[model samples]
Target: MKAFNIEDTAMILIDHQVGTNTWASTTPLELLQRNVIILAKFAKGTGMPTVLTSSQETNVNVQGPLMPELQEILPEEFAARIKRQGVVNAWDDENFANACRNTGKKNFVMAGVTTDVCMVAPAISALEEGFNVKVVCDACGSTNQIAEEMSWRRMERAGIGLTSTNAIVAELVKNWASTAGAIAFPLLT
Candidate 1:
């Protein structure tokens, strides 16, 4: 797959809710949160279309708000783009899927709370639907190490690209000589 072009890429954040994050033992919740913020800032600074979703908040048993750090980075106006889905796989929700499609971007960068379920499902679904998908592993987590590893393997075999938060930020910035780099370099480090 080609490198992410800022113009053609949309960042999709799924199930980064407090309740979902509390169950992640594969990666430190603090680190996962920080990476997520970095990605959000990258999208905001570069004007990349972004979609944020929280699953089953109203259902009894599943409940939580999006991480505060992630919410802070999003402008109040963009709140309309943040969808609350009833399904584990966000692509199953027409509102969430349409928000992404409306961006007119073919390349997608995804990061979510649960590596195996929330993250993997949408990444693969997007790929199957003809959207180029890149998973930001550092910004994602799983219930355990085994599930996380197995999910990554499955994603790789399905031809979905895996990348780090820093890589995605840097690739979008392009270079230190460019205007975006001048702003991004300080934030990335």
Candidate 2:
């Protein structure tokens, strides 16, 4: 497989919200949040087209609001986030799917609250749709280790690639002396 190119890749962040954060157990919430913020910063610095989605965030009792730092980091993408009513699979939500399609990107890098649900569903859907998909494992979590491992296997079986936040960042940036690397390197520290 070819390395992810900045021009052809889009970042898709799904249901990384306050309510879902409480259910994440496979990965620590702090590490998940930090990894996601790192990806968000990389996308923003590189001008990558990104899609941010939330599932019923208004119903704070259920899905609560998106991570506040996302708003502060990628303000424009956060503002344009597709707020789904109750779509379990973000790809099933027409608006979220359309936002991703509209980016004109063939490769997608994704992460979300629960690996088995929020991340897996859409990642597989996108792969079936002929898009090259990769999930940032460190940036995603699940309620348990079994669920997380199962989701990773499921995605791999379906031809979706698995990667880490740091790996993706380094792959895209290539070298610290380059412009993108210069912008992304600080976030790793």
Candidate 3:
């Protein structure tokens, strides 16, 4: 895909809740949290439109708010957190889909907890809908190595871009002299 243009790109963060993280094992919890915050900070610093969502909010088994680390960096007014009545695939939720639709952006940079379900489901959905999707692998977690690898393979086969936090940030920054680059460059390093 081409370079990420801030105007036409939005960050979609799904199901990165405290309850969900308890079973996440594909990536180290600490590192996953850190990478997520890194991406959140980049989006916050760049004034990118970010959409946050959770799964089965009303279900007692998996109930929690967005990860505190990410919530801290994203200002309430700037980050639009969609309340889905417990939709597993964010793309299935009207609010989440509308949020992305409202952004008027075709390119979506997304990451979420549980790579196979939370991450891959919507990534493929968005791709099928003709939206350009990029999955931040390191920032996404799964139940285990097999699930994570399988999810990556599934998304890759569908033509979605799989990348790392640093790579995505670098692609977005593009140049050090521009306004966004100047501001985001320091955050990445």
Model 3: per-residue lDDT, tens digit, 1-189?
667778889998888877787667878888888788888888888888888887765564675767877767876823567867767888988888888878788999999898988899899999999899999998898888999899999999999999998888888888879888877777767
Residue lDDT tens for model 2, 119-163: 999999999998999899999999999999999999999999999
Please give the lDDT score for candidate 2.
0.92
Alpha-carbon lDDT of model 1: 0.83
Indicate whether candidate 1 or candidate 3 has the larger lDDT.
Answer: 3
Model number with the top TM-score: 2
lDDT of 3: 0.83
Using TM-score as the measure, what is the rank order of every candidate, best first? 2, 1, 3
Model 1 — which ten-residue stretch has the worst lDDT?
A: 76-85
Error of 1 at 182 (Å): 2.3
Show the lowest summed lDDT stretch of 10 residues, model 3.
Answer: 77-86
Kindly report which residue pairs in candidate 1 clash with one another: none
| Model 1 Cα shift for residue 109 (angstroms) | 0.7
Q: State the C-alpha lDDT per candidate.
A: 0.83, 0.92, 0.83
Which candidate should be chosen as best, given lDDT against the real structure? 2
In TM-score terms, candidate 1 sits at: 0.92
- For model 2, the superposed segments whose C-alpha errors exceed 4 Å read none
Cα lDDT tens digits, model 1, 1-189, are 888888899988888887888777787988888788888887888888888888776553555777777657885524665556567788888888888888899999999889998888889888999999999998998988999999999999999999988888888778878877876777777
- In model 3, which residue pairs have backbone atoms overlapping below 3 Å? none
TM-score of each: 0.92, 0.98, 0.91
